[model samples]
Target: MTAPSSPDTQAENAEVIARQRVMRVLAQAPDQQLEELYEKFADKPDWTFARKPETGLVMTRGRIGGGGAPFNLGEMTVTRAAIQLKSGEVGHAYCQGRNQRKAAIAAFFDAAWLSEAHKQSVEANIIAPLEQEQLTAKKDKLKKAAATKVDFFTMVRGDG
Candidate 1:
């Protein structure tokens, strides 16, 4: 018998591996914790912040009114953030909301993910939670929308 196929096994594997790599980098905090990582290279001249346009499309599968055929949604625009540590280490992130603080925090986590020692803590405390939260919110919204689905169908006689 043949084993079942996973359509996105490679992509999922890549994402998981990337997450692991980030985790490992964040585990090498020199200051005893990931939170203090910023001060480690705070004095570096490369440290700076910038704003830019980000774009993405969430390909979602859903039944119209919870019982119809699945369909795709269009793309969306987002704001991206970037921070360069004094040591030339760059942190980047994209968020749906235009919040500076969230961007800063994401950049901080990205920087921590770049650290070899503090990577695990950063993944556990920051990246993982945020990712989970976003997934949960998306699922909830989809479910709610599905609950209110309305179906309309019409039939016509051909050549009476």
Candidate 2:
């Protein structure tokens, strides 16, 4: 067995995990959501992209009942983009569906969040709102699923 990761490594891993969470939330949000966010920014930030937005299929996987065996969930359409801000922060995004503009917007947000000047403002105005909307939607979905759940029970026989 390997020893535990160092404190600095652990912190870096934590940040990576948080970034993943933010990106996942952003990717699932609707295109209009991002469009609104784009309008909220004051001045346009200069950025150079490594490549134009591209769409491709990605193979998705799932585990049987959460943790049993892994299985392929079939291919999904995804759009990806990578960009670097003028200040040198790089960001990337892979979003579900064929909306390349959504991916580019998300990537720009990711890069902007990397800078200390924009971190707090972006997190408050963009990430926080998106995350809250996602959480609310998730709760609504869970409530719908729970409403359809049926409880099965056994009754004892009086003759026994």
Candidate 3:
């Protein structure tokens, strides 16, 4: 009942998806890890703060039983920043907690990812490793939780 997307539209959607993935990884990454990766970059491009890092509280929402009515789960601290590369690419980041430095670094990487010249290196050195580490951590946590899982069964009585 809808028209198919054109090639240009598809390409734009793909670009938006890729940027979303990058931002998701950056937002979930630890501040220490982001700082370390930022330090290791060989060519850090010059960038100006389009918006200075600022901390604020955001209301979080949750659904009851995963599918029921949604409710506010209280507020959590969040920091956000925006940066513009010298070449005109603009990047923005939002992260949990009050780590302004982390937000700035993440915004820098977001802008870097937008630039063709820096995308590959940023993906390889920063995004890939962080993704791998997070994956490993998740697996380990699941494994540990799985170890404690219990199964129960009842024996039937013949007298019935």
Whole-model lDDT per candidate: 0.55, 0.87, 0.94
lDDT of 1 by residue, 8-112 (tens): 776777766785554334332222333444344332244467544344444546688988987765544434567766555667765444444545545656765
Better of 1 and 2 by TM-score: 2
For TM-score, the strongest prediction is 3
Q: 19-109 in candidate 2: lDDT tens per residue? A: 9987887898899989889888766578989767999999999999988899998999999998888988888899999998999998988
Candidate 3 versus the native: TM-score? 0.89
lDDT of 2: 0.87
Residue 14, candidate 1: C-alpha displacement in angstroms = 3.5
Q: What does candidate 1 score on TM?
A: 0.44
User: Which pairs clash in model 3?
Assistant: none
Q: How well does each candidate superpose onto the true structure, as a TM-score? A: 0.44, 0.87, 0.89
Q: Pick the candidate with the highest lDDT.
A: 3
Error of 2 at 94 (Å): 0.5
